[model samples]
Target chain A: MSSLLNIIVVGLLLGGIYGLVSMGLNLIFGVIRIVNFAQGELVMLGMYGAYVCYLFIGLDPYLSIFIVVPALFLFGVIMQRFILQPLQNEPMMQIFATFGLLLLLQNVVLAVTRGQGYTAPSKLSEFVISVGPLNISVVRLVALVAVTAAALFLSWFVKNTMAGKAIRAVTQDRRAARLMGINVELAFMLTFGAGAALAGLAGTLLAPIYTMSPQIGGNFIMAAFAVVVLGGLGSVWGAYIGGFIIGLIEAFAGYYLDPALKTAIWFLVFIGVLIVKPGGLFGIAGAEEVGLREQN
Target chain B: MSKTDTMSGVTSTRDEGGAVPPGITTFNTELLRIAGIAVALLAVTWVYSGDPFILNIMAQTFLFAAVSLSWNIIGGFGGQFSLGHGVFFAIGAYTTANLYINWQISPWLALIPAAILAALVAVAVSWPTFRLRGPFFSIATIALNEVAFVLANYFGSITGGPRGLTIPFKAGLENMIFTSRFHSVLLMLGFLVVCLIVCAWVFRSRLGYYLQALHLDEDAARATGIRVLQVKLVGMAISAALTGIGGALFAMYLRFIDPPTLLSLPDIGVKFALIALIGGVGTLYGPLAGALLIVPLESQLRAGLSASVPGANLIVLGAILILFALFMKKGIVGLVMQLWDRFGRKSQ
Candidate 1:
């Protein structure tokens, strides 16, 4: 029971991270309607960024989010403007371009880092909280709170803010949004940038727990995707909920089944969910009509 | 084929169809042209390149071509990007490898059942997962492939696990192990011939027509009375069977089987996909042409570059994929066909 609780707690914590990272992936798909296969590599960059900062400036990872997020956001905006915009007319082209970016980013990191593995500073790695009869790592607990708060804050931003409304407008109907005098291009740019920032934030938080490597992003990205699919495409809240559900499933499966089979087991869950509800748990039923299906 | 003749006449009469430039001829007729070109190329290589090592590389390329062709049936034809097909290849390798090791059974005899078993496994897994399209199906295949690897690891006592199993040194047509590279080349040619025939047969079948339709537009195909799900399953089965055979042959050629080579990150998985994508996705002859270009380019690059610059070729390979993905989307075969159209027009 104690072990089970541990697994559950760990799962929830990890799920929160998954949710946090996937928010960007989901947001880009929601607004821009492109499945950035490079999303994982972007997270890898953020982790590396935080790692570099930790080494040089001795910045705490949590505090480093302020730096990593903005930097990544700027990178994301530039990527959208320079690399992605040319292929906006073609969906497959977008996939290829981003896929190129994914390969480029991964190999560049491998080349630069020489595939070396790095861990965050000792304090961040060691920071853990032990409650009575329960042990909760402070890093993860803080990550969960931070991620939840970020998600809630984004939701509020989307609901209340004019820029958020314009973003939503673009997502709902790009043509209509254009007609209404919204700068659709700028909206897409900002949306993509913000989404990338979220991925960076997730990476910054996760750098301490997970070792930073060129290939590290591939490990959790699959689970993050499962969360995206489970939450329903383009629904931020759905991503958060889906993350927790997948986390719970992972926790239970890891506890009950072979630990090595955890990834495959979760993939099975992904397939099952896809079969049962293509739209996902909190997915918009007719949302597919609003998104990039037309482009494909 | 009537379709080819009609398409040619259409291209000559008026330019139409934006997806395929009207001046661009249909793929059916272009395949024959590809075969003619391939034959000429092979003849040149056969007469000139006296080096057995070069012939050896070509043999390996032929084997990869077969694997890529098999991948195309499901991935290209069915429009299902499967990253887990290494599982089927591994299954085929393991099946024959185990049979040869334990009973000293002839590999030729073992391979038949190995192919069947691989196909059966494909069907079993695909039946549940085919319902989920796109990334879900892809991830499931990846997961299942991993599961196969894990199982292979756990059963180390009998299966030989990570250490792998090796076929005893035996020379004969019966044993399926060859002493000469020429013999392996002949065997690979035979395999490629069979796969090509199968691909041509598929292109002429109702299932092929349905698969192409579904690939282009699933909803449209469904509306037109094409059963998209059934066709996809059939394509997947055919694909699995072909890869299984390729795997069985691979075991015979190497006379050894290991988990790391058979089932691992971005080894077979990357190569097969890269070859298919590099050649052309939908065309039958695309993979063959792709493997021909890529395998040599890869070997040459690795031999020359990796010594001076570690992972240099990988960077180049990634760049090439991106380039192909962006610009040469139709791949080498598609390019050949396009150029053929352009030149053929000038002569007309």
Candidate 2:
């Protein structure tokens, strides 16, 4: 019973992080329709960016988030304009182009950093709160709160903001949006930047708990992918819910099964979900209908 | 006036109508392709025989090429970009290793069953994962590879775990051992030849058309009676089988199999996918071209940096992948084909 409770608690907390990371991926895939294979890499970069600031300037990683988020946003914008824009029309081209970008960025980080691993020095890592039999880490609780806040903010922004509407419009139908005088290209670029920035923020938040390394993103990317798929394609709520589900699964798996096989176990669940429900748990039903119908 | 003449600079005017250009016939195209293959075979064989070091490199290159060509069948030809090709490669290597060690089976005989098992696994993976498209498919593959690696590690007791298994060296045809590097080179060359021939046949057959159509537009292909699911399954099976064969050969060549070397992401599946991508995926000869350039370059780079720099190969390889992706999307073969076409036009 205690182990079950522990698993649920850790799972929910970790789910927030997964949700946080996957939200960006889902956002980008929803609006831009490009799977940023480098999404996790970008997260790794953000964590590294925070780590650099911490190492060089002695700034707290959580505080450095203020600086890292905007910088990553601009980096995302630059990548979108230069690398992703040209391949927008062809899905295969996008796959290869982003994959190329993944290879480039991952190697660059590995080369520059010499593949060093580091830990973030932050208050969150130290803070904790106890309630009866449940001893909760304050930092994780804070993360959960922050993630929920971010998800809510994103939902509100997409629902109310003019830019958000335009982004949504473009995602639904690029030709129709263009015909209606929407600058579809700008939306794509903006969405990509925003998505990347979101990933950066998640990385910053996560740095306190996790160690940073060039290969860190590889693990995160797979988990994020599973979360995104389980949540359903292009559904923000799905990402949030799916993230928690995976986190719980991982927490339990790590405790019961061998730690080495935790990832494999979760990935097996991911494959199962994909096989059972290709649309994902929260994905908008019939979203792919639009694209498939036009092709035929 | 003709599209072919305009593109190739061959004249189709009345002055030339009396005698058809020898180059324009279907027979000529086949002959040219055959001639190119023959020349490449001769050159590689010559290199294999002339220099012991070159023979070793040639053997490795052919092995890499064979893997890349196998990857291209599903990834490039069928348009399913799998980031986790290591699963099939690992399956092949491990199956052969277990069969040979535990069951006392010869590597030659082990390959057939290994490939069949790999194909079944590939099909099982496809049945579940093929429903995913775009990045989802790629990510699923990566996940699948991870699962395979973990499982390979989990069954450590049976698989020999991280310590790996060593095949006893018994030099004979039955043992699949070679006394000289030349023999290994010849063996690998045979594998390459078979893979290339299969690729070429697929490129010309009805399956090729179905694959191309699926790549272009899956829904449209399905609507046009392409049977996208059937074609994809077949492509995956073939890809896995070839990869399995490559793995079996790899085990035989190394005379040992460790989980890290055999099942690791870098050595088997990912390497093949990267090579295929770098060589002009989907093009018939692209994987061969990629293998020739990358394998030699990697070897040279490794030798050059062995003393001064430890991980220079990673940097160079990453740089080349980036450059290739950005500037040479079609790869070396694509560029060569373009240049050849231009020169052919000028001469005509």
Candidate 3:
């Protein structure tokens, strides 16, 4: 019984990490309707960004978020404007381009770092809090809190803010949004930026917990894809809840089954969900089909 | 029926009619072209016969050209961007390796079962995934590759797990093992020729037209009474079968089998599509053109930069992918066609 509780806790925390990693990916998929394969690389860049801050300025990984998020936002905006926008009409080319970006970013980092692993030191990472038989690390707890807060914040921002509304309008119908005097391009750019910033946020938060490697992004990207697909595409709450569901599944599977097979198990669930509900749990029905069609 | 008529057909017809109809080349003409290409490749192989380094590169080029051509049957022509082809490739490699090692069966015979099993698996997996469109399909395929990777590692008895399987050296004609690099290159050349013939046959067939139509618009194809799922399944099966044979050839050439070597996305899965894209996604000769360009360049880059800076070759490759995606969507064949239309037609 105690072990079960521990597993649940572990799953929830893992889910929190997965949720944070996937938020930006879901946002980009939701708004721009382009699958950013390099979003994981963006997060990887953020983790490295935080590391640079810690290395030079001696800032904590938590505090470095201030510097990293906006930088990533700007980087995202640049990538959207230059790389993705030109190939907007061609989905096949988009996949090639982004995958190219993934390899470029991953290998460039490898070249620069020479494949040396680094751990970002944070005071908060060292703390642990125990409740009865359940012991939780503070960094993971912080990630869980951060994900919940970000979800609430994103939901409110999309609902209330003009920029958020514009993004939503663009997502719903780009032509209608264009006719209604909304700058669809600008909205896409900003949304991509926000999505990238969120990835950066995830990176900064996660840096202290895991040993940083150039290939670590590959680890998060697959799990995040599973989370996004399972929860629902473009649905904020769905991503939040979906993260926990995947997390719980991974945790239970890891404990019950072979730990190495957890990824395979979740992948099976992802494929199962994709076949059964292509739109995802929270996505609008038929959106999956509609999203791929030419919008302009 | 004249050579000049076929060469200058597009422009000559354009002058007669306002809009040019697509030049329909017969199977005999395609066969002649294939023969021409084969002779040229053989000439190059003969020139480099004594040089082990060049022969090794040539062997790899032919092997990948065959695999990429197979990918083009479904991916380029049929318009299904599958990134999980590594699974089928791995299946072929493992099957051939296991049959040769465990049962002492010849790889030549094992090739039959490998191709059949690969086709079966391709049909089974693609049936469900075919429902997805564009990026969704690509994503699902990537997931599939990951799943296969895990399963391969898990099933230690079958795949030999993470440590991988290595075949002992026993050179013979029946074993599909060669004592000389020249023999291996010739074997790979045979594989490439088989793939080229299959692609050419598919390219001019009714199924090919149906695939092209569906690739343009699935709903419209369905409306026009095309069996969308069946056509895609057939194309995928053919593609997977050929890829399986390529895998068997690759296993025999390298005399080694492992999950990463066989199934790595960067190396095997994506490389096939990348080669197709670089040469001409849907063109018959594109994969060959692409493999010719990429394989040697990659080998050179690996030789030069791998010692100084790890992953420099991939950086260059990644940049090239992005640049090509932006500037050259139609690839080398498309560019050559365009240039021919602009210059060769005018000169005539």
Candidate 4:
């Protein structure tokens, strides 16, 4: 019973990390309808941004979030404006372009870092709380708290704000949204920037936990994709909840099955979900097909 | 004004007072074109016959060209942008390596089973995944590649695990291992010829038309009574089988197979699509044009920049991919066609 409890706790913490990583992806995917293969790279850049802050200015990883998030937002806007916006109509080109960005960012970092692993030290890295055979790291707890707060904030933002409503309108129908006089492109640029900013936030939080490598984005990318799919495309709450589902599955699968095979196992689950519910748990029934339709 | 079709096998164009439409060339003419291309490639091979470096590069170029041609069947013609073909390539490599290592089976004989297994796996996975459209399909395929990578690592007994499998050197035609680089070049050239023939045949066949129709508009194609799923499956199977054969040849040529070496997304999976895209997605000879340019350029970059900065080659390749996607969506073939059209019009 204690072990099961431990697994649940572990899963929830892991889910927090996954959820945080996937939030930005879900937003971009939901609104822009581009997979943004480089989102993980954006997260990686955020981690590095935190590292650079520590290296040059001696800023804490947590405080670096202020600098990193806005930087990534600007970066995202530029990328969407220059790279993705032109290829908006061509989904295939979008995939190629984003993948190109993935390779470029990853390798550029690799060349700069020379594959050396860096760890961004944080004051919160060593604290842990124990409750009746269940031990929780404070850093993880912080991530969980941050994700919940972010989710609530994002939900509220999307619900109440004019900008959020505009994003929703764009997601629903690009042509109709355009007819309503919404500058769909500006909305996309903002959404992408916000999404990138969220990814930056995830990176800052995650930096202290994992040894940073140029290829670390790869580790999160597939898992985040699983989270995004499980939760549903374009659904904020879905990504939050979906992250935990994947985390629990991964945690349970890792313990029960061969640890190495956990990724494969969840991939099977992802495929099954795709087969059974193509739109994901929280996604509209046919949103998966809707993404492929000529929105313009 | 009488003019011959320049964009033969690309798009069907009605010619004034002509019974046969331009771009719908007879099979014999395509065969002749293939023969001409083969001869041209052979001449290039003859020029670099003595240089081992060029021979190795040529061999790889042909191999990748063939694999990209296979990818074109589904990715280009059918409009399914798969990012998981590395799975099929790995399947082929491991299957052949296992057969040759364990059973003393000839690599040539192993090719048949490898192709069949790849096709089977392709059909099985794509059956469910075909329901996904656009980037969703790509995401699923990428997941499949990752799954294969994990499984390949775990199932060490068969795949030799992360340590990978290396075949012993035995110089013989039957063994498909040779000391001379020239022989490998010839073998790859032969493979390239076979892929070209198959692609050409498919390009002109009913299946090709069906694939193109669906590619243009899936719902409309379905409305017209085209069996969308079946057509995609058949195309994927054929593409996977050819990729499998290419993998077998790759394993034999390298005499080593590892999870990362075979299944790396950037190196194996995306490279095929990149070549196809850079050449011309749907054009018959695009893969060849792409391979001819990309393979040599990559090797040169690796030689020049890799020592100074690791992954510099990929940085350039990535930039090329982005630039191509942005400005040159139609790729080298498309550019050539536009120029050809201008010249033809000027002459008229």
* Superposition error at A249 for model 3 (Å): 0.8
DockQ of 2: 0.44
Model 2 stretches astray by more than 4 angstroms: A288-296, B1-39, B48-53, B306-311
For model 3, give the interface RMSD.
0.8
C-alpha RMSD (angstroms) for model 3: 3.8
lDDT of 2: 0.78
Taking all chains together, each candidate's TM-score versus the true structure is 0.88, 0.91, 0.96, 0.96
RMSD of each: 5.1, 5.1, 3.8, 3.7
Clashes per candidate (backbone, < 3 Å): 0, 0, 0, 0
- Residue A119 error, candidate 2, Å: 1.5
Instruction: For candidate 4, write residues A120-217 as lDDT tens digits.
Output: 99998988898989999988888899899999999999899999998999999999999999999999999999999999999999999889999899
Two-chain DockQ for each candidate model = 0.36, 0.44, 0.87, 0.89
Candidate 3 residue pairs in backbone clash: none
Measured against the true chain A, the candidates' chain A TM-scores are 0.95, 0.94, 0.99, 0.99
Candidate 3, residue B342: the lDDT equals: 76
lDDT of 3 at A165: 92
lDDT of 3 at A139: 97
Candidate 4 — which residues are off by over 4 angstroms?
B1-22
**What would the per-residue lDDT of candidate 1 be over residues A1-296, giving only the tens digit for each residue?**
77767888888987887887788998998788776778988899999988988889998787788899999999999988877666665554565567667667887788788888997764656766786567888778777887799889889999999999999988888887899999988988998899888889888888887888898877766777788888888888999888888888877777788776676677777777777777778887756434535541
lDDT of 1 by residue, B150-175 (tens): 77776786558888887788888888
Docking quality band of candidate 4, CAPRI definitions:
high
Instruction: Give per-residue CA lDDT, model 3, range A1-296, as digits (tens).
Output: 99999999999999999999999999998888888899899999999999999999999999999999999999999999999999887989989999999999999999999999998889998799999999999999999999999999999999999999998998899889999999988998999999999999999999999999999899999888888888888999989998999999999999999898998889889889888999898888888877777887
